[model samples]
Target: MRINSLPLRVRLTLLMAMILSIACFSLMAALIYTARIVYVAPQLVPKVSTSEEMGREPLPVTIPSVPPIPSAPPIPSVPPVLIEQQINFASTGFLCVILIIASGSVLTYRVAGGALKPVTDLSKEIEEIDENNLYRQVQVPPSKDEVSRLSISFNRMIRKLEKSFTAHKHFTANAAHELKTPIAAMLARIEVVQLGGPPSLEEYKEALQDTQCNAERLNILVHDLLRMNADLNVAACVTFSAKELFQSILSELAAEVQSKDIDIEVHLEDIPVYGERNLLHRAFSNILHNAIKYNKPNGSIQITGTRHPDTTRITIADTGIGIPEDQTDKIFEPFYCVDKSRSRELGGNGLGLSITKAVIDKHSGSIQVQSAMGMGTTFEVQLPNASTVY
Candidate 1:
């Protein structure tokens, strides 16, 4: 593989080793040159006499013998052959040093390459991975070194990515499935109305009404999906009285409340909460509507609001078909319903709880449900007291 494809550590290590080897070889060459210039050349050169008398004849100086005087010994004459030999030896030493440096560089390159083989292989393996194939793991060496730790971390990251991808796939599939049904029903109803038939006026009106209902259900589903996609930053905070908001929502749903024969009981306290008014209204409406829609005939619906020192809690309890224990958490997911058939019969798009969750998140509040399969369901919403805002 190309060098650029190698892992960062391996590439750096190889480059560093190459630079060091070149530096060491350069230093060795410089030392050899300096030694030759400072010591070897001077020692090899012959000395010449400068005096005129010395040029004419050898002056009979009192050159004492070994016992007569302790004078320096006469310099030995350097033969042309000896000079040539010294030159040859120095040339040979220089060649040897060059050869050694070249050999060392080659050896170092090979060793560096060998040491980084595992890292290079690991990089190639990781690069080849995609979402469909995230199960591959690096074959870590048994050395238990830094590479081993790196391999372990890489494996963990792959596992997490796999899980994330799976969840995304599931969400997409579920959302599509939920959206398709109502659309198909609307189309079928319209097709039936378009085909000319000898049905009575009342039958045509009823068919038109059914078509309109399905269309309205589709519209609500689309609107909820859009709201869920709204930017959280744009969800501005506004101070609103919790009791007044609840009362307003209840009053708006008065007709539905009456039709359901659900008795509305409001126990309000003076509690102020800071959040987006419109979003909060949507959340409140969803919970209260759910209470009314799921209640038994003439069941009592209780709405209570209380303020503590730090938080404001609102409870909407209804004697309805309570949720199962296993489905409490999943209820907040988009396109999820406890009873799919019943939800469809009741004209619920299954997006209410999901939108409520998004609104609650914007307010930095929490919502919890307490329910038993046969008893009843109570949804409690808690918001931080406005007095505690920093």
Candidate 2:
């Protein structure tokens, strides 16, 4: 097989085995060489006495004539080399090396597989996850190893992605539903006017007014949708005074405040907040407008701003028909209206709070609502202070 085509475990095993084989082969060769020097070399040389001088003359001695001495037994000669020993050793060492290579490669393969089991499991789990199976999570190993930690982080990232995808689908469906209403209204009104041939000035005026109103609503909704989706580059974000922001929002909605005959009270302190000014302004406008739109005639509304070293809080409280306790948690969801009929009467598209929440989220801030049925509702927004931002 091609080396590159092998699995990581197999590749690692083969590489490790090759390294160990090279080392073992060198060690075996050294052992054989040492055996030849210690055992085989000694037999190749005759044992010569140092006392016998090669060039020295033999001493003259009186010789006995023809004396015959009987020897009990003759000494056997020792073999200079053991070819069988060398052959046995060489064969054994070669067999041992082959055995080691075979067993070691298999053992290393097992070890590698054990180490990579988590990766295999993670891959399988990821492959199984899709839109229908987004809730599936990779099984986390109990051991606090790198593999286990990596799996945990992958699961965390997948969970975040799943949530984002789900929200996107929901947002898309809600936008379609919201846009459908205004467009349908305009179409219906035009069809009606066309069916009624050449109407009177009053009738034409009313029909035109309704159509124009629906068209304007459609335009506003489209603008808000675009704004919500448009990426706000954080590099352009800056700190602006919270005090001035609220005052400006109040001034902009002064006509609405006056028409409702609502009492507006403000207690604000100069404070800097970190965010995109336009998005923050939009968020603040939504909250303040909701307070006004839902306020009781001749009722009271309170706007308070406080600053801390790390955070700033803005509270918009109004004495209006409050949201139900059970539904408070879902009020921030896109196109989730507490009172659908009442919301339609007030021309509320239900995207206001969704946009506000998105803005706050973009700034890493939070918004919460406090309310009870028939009692007043309070929306409190908390933003990171400019001083606390990096």
Candidate 3:
């Protein structure tokens, strides 16, 4: 089998076993060589006599006459006991090497398993988590190492996913509710007209008008919902003048402004911005539309624009019935309205600000609102300056 196909623990144990086996065999060879030098080599090599002993030996000996004797059988070069000892040493060394390698392999396998236990546990914990149990967190090992860090990162990811899932659920429910209201209204009205047989021209006209209004509301709701989820096309973006854009919006809403007799004040520095012009226009128009719709009669609306080194900021402040402090943060949620009855009266589906926020985010810009109860509200928008960004 391929080495990689083996489990990590097995691979580690094998590697360690290889190293231990090599070391044991090398040690055995060295011990055998040392034994040969100390025992066997000495027996094989004849010793030389010293010069003084050789010089003095001839004077002390006297020759005696004797009969000649046959030489005994030639002595063996290596003694039998020495050969047996050498064989015994070789056999013992081989057995010791084998014993050491076997024990070392067992120890290495256990050590590898202990080292990998944390990782195995973490994997099992993660496997048990699914969408239904996203809230469940993996046990972070106390050993402040890579395994602990991995657990922490996974927990963070799970938290973010859970939050996103919850928000998605809320959005789906709100969208359905918003869609159902208009459809129900139209259906109720059509049913009434249908049940009333042989109705007069005036009654029919009234019913038709009511149905048409509900249908229009449904159409706008669907359009804004689609816009909120739509992906912007970066290729279609271009730089445009912020002042001119506001002027165009104001001009389009001139009739409402005239009827409300709301004074319009414009003090702008023709700040250039980089983004999709149509999207930017819609975002600014939504804010302005809310200001007009919610403002008190004859309330003054002030529009101002300032250019910073890297950003362009525009603020539209109006003398409108201000939003409650607690609900200000939630004003941009889809289908969320501060004053539901008033919003319906003004023909709003509560998606205008949501769409505005989506558009601003697409342009890498930010929008904020500041308001006090019974006081006026102001919306501030900041976008990247074309000159600086390009």
For all candidates, the clash counts are 0, 0, 0
Q: Write the per-residue lDDT of candidate 3 for residues 108-210, one digit (tens) a residue.
A: 8998899999999999999998777878989899989999999999999989988888878988898899889989998898899889888889988998999
- Candidate 1 lDDT tens digits, 265-333: 888767777777888899999999889888888888888888888888889998988999999988988
Which candidate number has the best lDDT?
3
Over the stretch 1-390, how does candidate 2's per-residue lDDT look in tens digits? 799998999899989899989988998999999998898777666556543466666667677897779775544344534777887898899899989999999999999998998888878888988878777878888999988998889889888988888878987898898889888988898788889888888888988899898889989999887776777678878978777888899899999999999998888766677889989999989988888898889989998888877898888899998888999988888888888888989889888998999889878899999998778899999998666767
Residue 152's lDDT in candidate 1: 87
Model 2 lDDT vs. the true structure? 0.86
Task: Name the lDDT value of residue 292 in candidate 3.
Answer: 92
- Tell me the TM-score of each prediction against the true structure: 0.62, 0.71, 0.74
| Candidate-wise lDDT, in order | 0.80, 0.86, 0.88
Residue pairs in candidate 3 whose N, alpha carbon or C atoms collide under 3 angstroms: none
Cα RMSD of all models vs. native, in order, equals 9.2, 9.3, 8.3
Q: Report clash pairs, candidate 1.
A: none
